[model samples]
Target: MSDTHAPTTRLNKRMAELGLCSRREADEWIARGWVRVDGRVAGIGVQVAPGARIDIDPAARGHQQEQVTILLHKPVGYVSGQAEDGYQPAAALVQARSHWRGDASRQRFSPGQLRGLAPAGRLDIDSTGLLVLTQDGRVARRLIGEDSTVEKEYLVRVAWGEATVGVQPLVPPAALAKLRHGLSLDGRPLKPARVDWQNPEQLRFVLTEGRKRQIRRMCELVGLKVMGLKRVRIGAVTLGQLPLGQWRYLGPDERF
Candidate 1:
């Protein structure tokens, strides 16, 4: 006997696949009667065939447009997420008083902007630079999701062994090559990275993966000690003159 299951999928999943919203958001909209299938309101867990027509209420789109993304020039000492060991989280710096005066965007600071806003990616307590916090789930998923291929660029200060007279304390070319490809952390090989020297004391790393303390660990593996690490860019967005401990809105035209 032949099997006879139709190729159907959950309504929420289909909505997410269509870039309308995330599955969770789709469920919320469905519960709120903001989603429709074949011109009728959809219900939670509803499944439909491949040809089903999905419609989202215009109000849902407006609400999504109001969601905000913030780019913080995080200073060292604050954890990226929750407060830990008495160290404040970077989100605490997003208050109105802390808004960057140099911000060219017309967006105004509001208390409601803080609600549900969360860090999209992490910056180690000891490191500093561009850190993203957002209320938009789509932006978070785009930047830190499992399949995200966004590149994060960092400038890391390193120290090799103490310099001796007539000798340089620099990482060898062979080791630098390894930083570009050959390395492992947590018993797994790392993805290939773009590692190059920015100056005598610093290395510029462009990586697609953000493992825990990853840059520091990568430097350690190459026999270099990371003295300071600062993320300068995530995808096309840059830290670009945003003063430390201040934030600015991700502009309308900006992506990633």
Candidate 2:
């Protein structure tokens, strides 16, 4: 944010416009001395206006800007964001063959969007379901960009070889089966998840961010092993029976 009353703007406002962080968060960081401007520690009262060179810490910058923003019903074995050891990028699944239209004007897929397209977030190669690819900067910035707080939902199927001679875990075996739950993979203690059962062997997952093998890891913590994983939603958008390995542009009314 830039300074005010001194021909500059408040620091928090500047940070928000640059997509560095939310103004509220910037204020907190400034108070905590975590932000600097031009090598000088920034205070909450500091002012900066547009075009001033700002240096936010690298971790604070976060990966940003989805180029295409297409959502795919990813099939297992297609990696979400990267082309990893013998794994193809889930992004590769997007082709002209998959475009569907409710509004013809928006149906025009630009080659520029295609050539510049890539996944803003990830879905591991072994996991499947709703994966988003994007070219829209706002969606990318909001969903995969560093300051993103979008929620993702999934359905997980799990199996266990044995129970510890105890009744069952409080985490719930029934709830773990085809149920909804939350996850965190940054090694921070996870946010509370809403877990429930859809059947006996499946658990639904809703996460705010993607961490490496988060659902699988969470299942392990509960003594269950993941047999299958599928993301069903992201934000308010749903996969809605879209076939695996197929993709479609998000609808205008969709709220992801």
Candidate 3:
């Protein structure tokens, strides 16, 4: 007899949890007979139990390969997502005119590529540097998923005590240690971060979590005020020499 008490979840949800695709994409693949579970073609909304084998058709894989991921050197004043308070979204800069001439990818600019392209993570309007926009759900999920462990690196210029531009005050070592692992925000403890002095004026930070205004808030808690913030790297990818307000496709050999 079958174990009727076994827990089951929607096939699309299972696919999403497995990093296969977004739930919507999973539903589309199922409708197109591109998904198989336990050696049978899956249907939309099909329920799956633990350890159930799942497979994807080659056609589905081909479609996924066509989806694109774009890396942008975002400039300050542009919001990472939708337009708000008169500031344009960063996606507006993905135009052909703004495509980096040095982009090594063979892919050319196309209007269709913008249809579903969206920022995978937020880069505050006041902050600048690397911002990722992608049409591939897999890329989005991998970078910003709730359980994601990808490291985001930033160069932060901070002021201690009074606000004096270009003046670097001596920070207590205990405070620096707190910035690395002992801070909490919104009443929740923060994950340990890699924080160190890049220069007398700038601090280099590497964090696996992205909380809203997290770095800035952490600095404030440690008696430091952030003057400027710029994200430089995410996972294995760096902003590199991508010019400000320009974008480039993620190369075929690139991951993360």
1-256 per-residue lDDT for model 1 (tens digits)? 2123668898888887676777777888899999988888988998887788787899998989988899999998999999999999999999999899998889999999998889999999999999999987788878887788999999988888664222224557888999999899999999999988787788899999899999999878878888889999999999999999999999999997
Full-model lDDT for every candidate: 0.88, 0.67, 0.90
- The TM-scores of all predictions, comma-separated, are 0.91, 0.67, 0.94
lDDT score of residue 140 within candidate 2: 63
Clashes of 2: 29
Superior by lDDT: candidate 1 or candidate 3: 3
Estimate, for each residue in 172-207, the C-alpha lDDT of model 2 and write its tens digit.
554454223443345576655666655655666666
Considering every candidate listed, which one attains the maximal TM-score?
3
**Clash-forming residue pairs, model 1:** none
Model 3 spans with C-alpha error above 4 angstroms? 1-4, 163-169
Worst 10 residues of 3 by lDDT: 161-170
**Clash totals, every prediction:** 0, 29, 0
